[model samples]
Target: MAKFISFAISILFFVSTASAAPKSDLWERWDLSNEASDVQVSHAQWSIFLSKYAAYVDPATNTRLVDYSAVSHKDHRVLKAYISMLTDIDPLSLNKAEQFAYWVNLYNAATVDLILDNYPVKSITKLGGFFSFGPWNEEIVEVSGEAITLNDIEHRILRPIWKDKRIHYAVNCASIGCPNLYVEAFQSSKLESQLESATRTFINSDKAVQFINGKLILSEIYNWYAVDFGDEKSLIQHLLNYYEGPLYQQLQSYSGEIEYQYDWKLNEKK
Candidate 1:
């Protein structure tokens, strides 16, 4: 009886440990070594697809609304082919900037493919597993022999490896709360300016910052990932860097708590 009880305890311990372990730590393990600078990455296909399907609601806001309903059979095929091509390319063989731009485009294209696969749905969270909020956990793509998910692309690959807060603007969540999905594909040649533009556009947008009831309101992104932007003071300084006009001047003298909110509605065209 004593031996049997010991065996049961060992089994219980194993079960608990296994349950606590995350299935993947791809982000923690990613490291890019300097490689050949001339490796070819064709963003033309992705650019063409985006121009045809994505539309800006208002140029002033830079808000993009995807026309998921208008995706033709050919366009869907093209995007799938592009994603497949990405999986075959080794990031280790490309320069760091190229790899960075590659992952961003691949992630965005894959997300659009997933949403197009289940179009007409009210929200991306509605698709895939009935018990989950969205397909963030599902291993939906393969990259250089490793299976990856949307969560892996964002949290693991981009956020952890790049360690850039501006990355938040680059990876779209297919929801209104997310930064506007850029209609142009990211390219290594233009990465710096692209990242800067994305960050500035999002920081200045009403979706990210708003003044309400004599208080400051910010996107839940700033609240949820506060650590990424450092402390509250750091966040305000970061915003000031991009903001100009009256908003910048107003923040210069304001010291108060930031209220946070997010909209999860699918950013689809009407």
Candidate 2:
């Protein structure tokens, strides 16, 4: 079975990488093709697994801690099945909204699967690959016969196609510095509301923006995806959309250079 799966993935990687055409600075929208149509893609299986094992330390901080050790053997099998179901669905056949939800959920799910397969790791960055520390660049899943990686889903597909800064919130890296993973799987029906809520919630968290020595220290995500949030002034405006209280007032009054930091510790439950 493992050999068969490996052969299948090899073919997918060749096809997906070989047929790629040049993309413009902007990615084309999904569901724009003449053959595109709506299709049902269920995330129930993933939601069930999450509800059984995921939890937030405190609602106020939105710090999620996944009980990796608590995940039983049966649940792992269920997760593999969910990933298989997602892989079988042709994302090109789904509408724009469903496509967006599909990629986000798939990325998050794949990330979890990677961590689970190598449980007890202190950090995701510990999952070393040929050229990098983390396995982000590894093509761990295939969809519609196209082998895809976490980086491909986030950078190549979601980020460029949507051009929405809120995407950084929706996709979690299973790290303490990353945004909290949503307990419920993202669905096409609630895509808009979920995206809005994710953005608002993350910005309101101390991880998003905070003061240190009177300097505004932001997440390295904003720096890494600087273009996604626009200029520093514009990024501040975006944060103000959800930030409040004394820090909000401080951000409003203080105008200087902003620094960034990130913690790669696993978001595992104690």
Candidate 3:
């Protein structure tokens, strides 16, 4: 099954690129014809996030990684079309408040595609080399008419300005601890609801915290961003807010073994 899947990926990669021919580019450097799905990102606000945030992995050493430039032409056309919608729509045209949220969502989603592009076989940590910070690259995105790094976005904009610790949960780095990447583009109207849903979904998922054998195995994200999840509140409280159904109740008074682990593997075509 694995071999066939990989083979199919290979065929799709080449076939899609055959008809490439177009002109004019957003962010200027990247083109759509040869690399259409790259139309994956838009919005001038998101420009900063893509320009500043997102860790870039070196494709040379990362043999097991998925060459996004290759396969982006295929897989999930609706999602790609939505991204194109972003490009076609004038972000400046949106209201100031709406524009900010639009950029944030675009940046986060585009980053997901960037990681999936190199979506590697080993842990995401493995993708980063000696000089690399993590398996991500801030360079994959284009923003503010300049290419920026991921560190800039996280430390500078998202964390500081938004001041909402829960945001850490909203932007999935395609890591296990992160909220699962939303299948579609995050629209401005849905920002607040999206963040709330993303927080709830990620915390409750098996990847973050799970109720198994009367124990609570948690994700490292909780530990790393414990303060963001309201370090003021006990870990139990944090979990309760983000989880619902039985899990919420189970965590109320439940004390069990605490386990934390993360998966860096790309959330590829399942």
Candidate 4:
């Protein structure tokens, strides 16, 4: 009887531990392992909803409260879903290391989406006004069982663990000046690819920068995060690697822009 009782207790312990263990990730929704080519995903969903951005936006209010009942990127419904998924789910519910990665990436991605929800504005900073204002400070963007602020996710988690500089590109601030808004959601598996692509895409655009007198005029981003790109004297060298063209030599010779002109206007969906 004693032996039987001991065996039963052991079995119960094993079962409990198994049940409590984090879930195995059977699926990675997004994959961009192939670094040879730039990855592109569908924007049809976002485009469809954004087509009506002009109709729903209220200029006087300078507020963007569109129909996000659905999970449409353009409609901004995905923002709410992302927040819901992040806040309600348990962290330990996922496997240990994966849990942290998932948390940080989700925090970064969802924050961008939520900020964009109050979209149709000229600038993300506008959301915050002087002397005390702005929704960004609201804090506690609930997501995946986590109640965290943008500062928490950015400074605390992402900065500490991930040393990669491309994170700057992945986390959009939602102004015309910010990196181009990605349509689909960001998953861990696709993190590297998304970051690379965002960096290349943004730096290549005319809004943030322009090619002047054969010189590579860069956005303030390069200036602000010059050290982040790579340890090089010239900030322009970092961008040239991604930009492969006849102008490569030209960029090296001339990476300095006379000045930068970032569009404070909201990336309106007109």
| Model 4 per-residue lDDT tens digits across residues 1-270 | 999999889878754543231211212222112334233332233334434432253343222323323334534665455455556655434443344345544554554465556544555555643422233444656544345655555545554445466656655454556565553445445566766776776665664446776655556665555555554444566667576555566666662434655544554544
Residue 81 accuracy (lDDT) in model 1: 94
Q: Quote model 2's TM-score.
A: 0.85
Residue by residue across 55-84, what tens digits does model 1's lDDT show? 556554447889888889988998999999
The C-alpha stretches of model 1 lying farther than 4 A from their native spots are 1-29, 58-62
- Candidate 1 has a TM-score of 0.87
Models 1 onward score TM values of 0.87, 0.85, 0.59, 0.60
Q: List, residue by residue over 234-270, the lDDT tens digit for candidate 3.
A: 7777667667656676778775567766665554333
In model 3, the runs with Cα more than 4 Å from the true position are 1-96, 116-123, 133-138, 145-147, 232-234, 255-257
Off by over 4 Å in 2: 1-36, 58-61
Rank order (by lDDT, best first): 1, 2, 3, 4
lDDT comparison, 1 vs 2, better candidate: 1
Cα lDDT of candidate 3 equals 0.51
Worst 10 residues of 3 by lDDT: 30-39
